[model samples]
Target: MSDSIDSPIIIDLPYEEGGKKYDEDIFARALQTETHQKTGQVESSNVTEYHLRILLHYPAVYVIHAEESHSQRSEPEYCVYVGETNDISQRTYEHLYNDPQNRDDWRLFNNHGNMSQYVITHPYFNKSLTLDIENQLMLYMSSVDHVSLPVNKRVNPQRDYYTHDRFKRIFSDIWLDLHRKNPSLFPAEGIILDSALFKASPFHKLSDEQLEAENIILSEIFAALHLESPDQIATDKTNPADSHLILVQGAAGTGKTVLLSHLFYRLLTQTLPEEDAPLIHSPASAWKSDDKHQDGDHASQRNLIPKEDISAYILVNHDEQIHVYNQIATKLGLQNRSGTVVLKPTEFLNRHSRKNDRHRALLNEPIDKADVLLVDEAHLLLTQGNRAYSGKSQLFDLLNRAKVVVAVFDPNQILQSSQRLSPKIQKLLSPADDSAANPSNNGNDDEPSRIQLDDYNNAKPLTVDVSHIRLQQQFRIDASPEVIAWLDAFTDEGIIGELPADCHEHAWHADDSVDTRSKPYDIRVFDSPVDLFDAIKKKAEIKADGCDGKGLSRLLATYDWEYTSKHKNANDPSGHWNVELHQDGTGTWRMGLGGGDGTDNTSHDRCFCQPWNYQLTDPHSHRKGLNKDQAWAEKPYTINEVGSTYTIQGFDLNYAGVIIGPSVQYQDGKVMFHPENSKNKNATNSRKDLGDFAEENLKDELNVLLKRGVHGLYLFAVNPQLQQRLMDVYEASKND
Candidate 1:
């Protein structure tokens, strides 16, 4: 067991007294005498003033010293003072009885009674000295009380009256005894005795077990501490001579959020010179106090600005993820009174609004007035263009003001239609700009220049780059390793070694009905827009009976299937598929509707009309509108009929039935999935080629969709050729 101090212990003493002079020799001899009485030591002459004070203040020790000194008038004065006391009253009584003899020796005394009075006055001349001595005495008495046992046990006391050496011994004993009684109570095993005892003890160093535990904790702290801002990183890397930018890529479940939070903590806690400290605005600064000025005016007054600035560990994401990040920040104790801000696309537009002159005015102000910027999901950034001015995205504008910028993005998940890096951002991340020299430019001035903007105009700034570290090892899947492996082998086909055998054996299983020709693992696809409507209605009915436990009529049908189908089909086929599939996959389908004409239009024209009826046309307006009447002339569409791709991306059913509508695939080879036909014709082609890209793209999407089940896949093809191609791919990949 090693001896180290386990917990903090404080000792307070009275202030020191001055004025009286003493003979060093006599003081030394008196200390030796006290030491001999307490610890049988003859080496008291070697003791320091500090040790002498401790001995004198010890509860059971005392020191008496006599001294003589010349006054300013050249008169010799003699004085004597007692430096310790066991009983105050008894000591004073003794001093009174001996005062007469001491006074008779003084020539200044007029008479014996006067001499005694003068002698006593010499000792108590300074009331401050007396107070100090009293305070010291009280301090030692308190120490005795602290370590003392109960009053009843004082008589049979565990130890004798306190001595300097005895106090040291007992303190060590008590600390060790506590450890022996409850070892686990200490943070680490073993105990740290008092410093004095630690020096004396042979076992003062850490044990092997203790050292190992200390190393573990130290490692965790070090890892947590290394996270810093780009500026700080630059300073650390000794690269302050050049400006640089860094990008961090990480996937979900990685410690990106935790790392960012740690960085913020470090930035806030960093010690900066008084003048150089970063100016930060706190939530309190934005709030007004109720207190009025002395003039009794009604004007609002700002609260006192705290000397310490309150900064945040901000987590930036789309509006949908804001609630989740806010909850995480709150859990980590980083949330402040100002609350979290979710920077939506519209908010960005509002900040740089063309129509709002006031907003434009605000944009012209100095940018450094804000704190550092941290962007998560950086890949979602997009550029803007207008007839008046070529514009950069809101994210680029924010980067100009921040001294340190930290961004996290996964290149694989860039979902925006225009998913190309802006020139400024590209320069920041990868400085070598080769786009200008490309032969395809043909000296055309109409083409946008790919020049990097020197936005900050700073002499030098720091940049730090970090790669994504795997955190998948920590996720424990509660399924058979074999089953999980089989699913991963198919869905993540090219990405090998992802699923272990343990994951596949415990996976859940489900089978499909043979009549539907749908394998248990196959995703159910609707035959046509009308068939999709019917299938959804049937599912809703089943859900109402089995899960919702309510009559089908009770469930509200917010959107008319026919109207939604027509409106969705109105878009270019690729755009339509992208909106439906991505929205449904990411569980953000609601955002797609919340943003556009989906919210506007007359009551009848709105896709989601009121009431629970899923009919394609209003019964009351059956004969009112000619076009609407013709559309719904055949039969009423019910909730059981309509389905959207968004509702079933990651899900799998026992049987899958797909309907390839003519809008997507035509016999004349007018394929909507062709890369050349896409909105951005020049975009890089994925594994799927031009003409049949839609069907091929659906292969992977459907793979992700179907493998969610345990047994098999059931796929239906409305277009025989497209269906045959999909089946061929699936069958070929199965053996591989």
Candidate 2:
């Protein structure tokens, strides 16, 4: 896991003894006994048969090795082949030598007649499990320095774990046996553990409850899928009508994203290792054509469902989110998998819509298809697709087409007018009749509506009732209960009171009298933005020098800035910021201006304008380039000022320097918002009419900005009155 380019090679995989005793294992006997006992029990026989056949084949993982010298290193390296085969003798023969008819078919070894082979076999292995082992082996081999990469191209496998303890023990034994068989090649402590990867993986890191939620969702999808039969589908030539909609409701920091990541992986790959067993009978193996045409054709004529019968896609709305998702997909190897695409919602809609002429030709025929669709930040689904989607609402369109739709919904996160759900969808989400599904209990105003059983059951054949799951636990902020309670009250009522009695003592507190050094969370109220900027810089430098545990900090602010409608060419004699601070006293400062003339830009000293976070127009070439976010992440500094909701949403920071702009102010003992003062047309336009959507979104944005800081939240306000009000609220909450 270390970021070492040339670490010494350390292998601990021993050669052979105690490796292939799979036939005698208790797991093998238990599977046989269970399969026989369940012969007449049709309800459980399918699952039992799956386990029985997997244990019977007794799969083996083998390695083919050949020594070679490369120019990159002084020492010779080995081109090692690691694979699993049910028939090791035949498979190895084919790999080392050639077929009687086609010599190229056996060219895996290439001119290297001299080779050594090693193997570890197990009785209870499936396609999913074998792929997992091969992937881990590749990762380990790739980690070694001066070692030629493994000859196999591993397909990243989902960590489809066994639910049975016996099966778990069998897999563990195989792993240990392999290490013992080749100690010089497989290091004992070298490769990272799957559990470790699960923790660090963007797709994992969920609580037990969240894991349960994932299982429930999968079970529901499986239930719907089970309703379709191959014979029926082939005859009807119609997409199945058993789709279901699952609504996941959670607020900003409630780990909806983490859940979505887990869902994306689990859905695309098999979830349980034993679920798809009997490799010989699997549709994939059956479909492999060879010179034994009759034999291959006979094998392929089975009633098994192809893996592609179900497909999963993870969809977002923004390009930045797509970039982040694509990176994660590549890391997890999901990017290589067929039927799994991570893209923006618009792209997804366009690809699936029949309206796109190019798509019809590319895909052979236009048909709306997707077994499962996971929509992250569902609140961001556009009510209008900007004419690209032919004006269809993304949510309803997806629900109608996909068999299983899972959405992470947060009403407060809807910042644009285009993202509003229709009235019918809204009613389904939040029924005006259900009292229990009210705002007070769920922490969000809109909750999924309670559907009467008859409503869906009596409706059209394909219609589905929406199921809602609300997640309440907060994971992003490490604050006391009182602090969270205070934040909630502040957002809800624009004020705060004495700290709640149940609140625990933590790093966060706001009394000026308290010792600042003792509190990890330094809640500060600064009158001047310049001083706040200096303090954030000092912290960043300390962090950069390895003095602070909580990593990098960044500056953030309210969208009281006008994102200029006038497009300025990067070559324009005068460079202008797409986002200009629209406050009365604020001056226009362009990013990358470089202290020009040092006159009108006192603001430059306080803001380190980073153009990478937002798109920039190159004036000289009239081209758009230089992603500020990519650049800033590589070389982060507190002074590299850049952040807006678009860039910072769904991301976490160590400390946040917040500047409350003039758009929001303290007036007549209440917080007031002036949309005219804000140039963010989206926020301003989103506020007009229609209840508290705008108000809630604005508060949510600030709440998100404030809670981003893991260790501290530094504050500055354009309006002095609002600054004093916040300080007063913080102080009142800390009083005994």
Clashes of each: 36, 18
Per-residue alpha-carbon lDDT of model 1 for 32-111, expressed as tens digits? 55446545756423343544443233232121212234233232222212232433223333343433344442222212
* Tens digits of lDDT, candidate 2, 1-736: 1211111111222222232433324333444443344343332555434443443344656666666655644445566666666654445445543342354423544555445665444443555555455544554443333233323433233333552223333343444545554554543422322112221233233465565566556555654565454655676653445456778877667777877876675455433222232333221232221223111132334444544556788988755556556545643446653224887776775577554445431212225678889988888887654545544356656665577788888877776766776565577566344443322343222322234222221223235546667777767655666666666665567664544433356432232232322243456766456667678777665432111134466777777654454675464344544233221223432222334545443454444433323444333232232222232222343245556777666656656788777767788887777666665666656423243345556766676667666566788776767877777755664674
Best by lDDT: 2
Full-model lDDT for every candidate: 0.29, 0.53
* Every model's TM-score: 0.33, 0.60
**Each prediction's Cα RMSD?**
27.8, 14.0
Q: What C-alpha lDDT, on a 0 to 100 scale, does residue 130 get in candidate 2?
A: 55
